[model samples]
Target: MSGRSDKKGEMMMVQADTRIVDVIRQMQEQRKQDRQIFYDIYSQQEKRQDPEKKDTGLFFFRGEKKAPFAVVCAGGGFYYVGSVHESFPHALELSRQGYNAFALQYRTGGAEVACEDLAAAISFIFSHAQELGVSTDCYSLWGGSAGARMAAYLGSYGPARFGGDDLPGPGAVIMQYTGHTDYTENDPPTYACVGENDGIANWRTMEERIENLDAAGIRTEFHHYPDLQHGFGLGIGTSAEGWINDAIAFWQAQIDES
Candidate 1:
């Protein structure tokens, strides 16, 4: 890493459990192939109006043209955006599986601001779907830790609640390692996973939420991997390894039902 790359890497709280290098390599490959990997969700005028929006954008990992898309948000406890460790890799994997994927780079500081950025990002993608070559239908939202709360909030209340346009929420919401318990009767179908040993976000909290969703007659799936801890991006090589596949299936099931 050097220059801007090094600067970006410095912002990441690199952990032994994360595959930051792999994400960097994949991003490099995408750039080498001449793909437009990043898109500013906010226009220049918007950024000028609110300088905080300058860091907000979407990093794309393209799949089949016009295929359904997903937006992945990485968690950093609202202090930083961990897209390299948590989101970019997931988007790359999703693209490999033939789904257009985007890793969101949102402004950090507070939950409300983050959710607003997410809503704005969703609106940006929807507005540019045709030019971006992605289907507006059956799109999903994914996130880990604090980011999971953002996804769930948007899933429950919708983008309009967060200052975005009146738009349909995701067909599914995939959450990881978060203890968010909020829900609404109209929340999208949801799939969630957490590590039982996660000290920051107790697995019981997640399980209880899932149970509540089920009791409310909402489509849901929950998984808790024993002995694993928090921030296990992709859970690769752990008991939670391959969990993303299960989540993908859950999302697909929602699409089928819809």
Candidate 2:
């Protein structure tokens, strides 16, 4: 289905990229191969305790068993989740690169709640790493826009700060097109990209954050694509094309160092 046709409420900046359809087809192929694609991060009891969690889950894209994993969170300005346009395609691509990937379906309406869900999701994956055939080591977090803020916050402060387990932060954090300005000396290695023409998220803010990270002695990679705007997922046919590969390389470099 086209992203335009599948658009839901309050979801702005939805990209009409063909990668969405390709990812959906790949999901079907995975299912046909008897793979379980969707998993609930919250148990039935947890959902019953807080009904808001009923809308949250994870969509798995398998690669090599025991490979490092990444969690991709979609941008929706903290009001909704644009996973179809943002996260799923990225996860599919990551899986093809032989890394286990999960697209998060997080509860929206606010950033705090959403980040709490993210922390919980990370805790769940770590708890079930053996069963899921994933390596907890060198895992990464990927997100766009508001989702970028979520990943950055978690990367800076950790899951324990968000009421989850006292897990170590990701090896790397990949963020796209966000104005988040918070960071610390302890943050994970970060890779950030934004379009020069992105009005909603001023590229300068992103640059400033990267500058701060670098000043703090944290490794960072930043890219500002000319003439592109916000939410340009995968940046296909644009100057931002092939950026994900660069981010993956950055993540791999961190893994190697670890």
Q: Rate the local accuracy (lDDT) of all candidates.
A: 0.89, 0.91
Which tens-of-lDDT digit does each residue in 22-131 have in candidate 2? 88799899889998888898889999999999989899998899999999999999988999889998998999999999999999889899999999999999999999
- TM-score of each model, paired residue for residue: 0.92, 0.93
Best prediction by lDDT: 2
Tens-place lDDT digits, model 1, residues 124-166: 9999999999998989999999999999999999999999999
When summed lDDT is taken over every stretch of 10 residues in candidate 2, the lowest stretch is 5-14
Best by TM-score: 2
RMSD of candidate 1 to true structure, Å: 6.1
The predictions' CA RMSDs to the true structure, in order, are: 6.1, 4.7
What's the CA error at residue 169 for candidate 1, in Å? 0.7
lDDT of model 2 at residue 92? Answer: 89
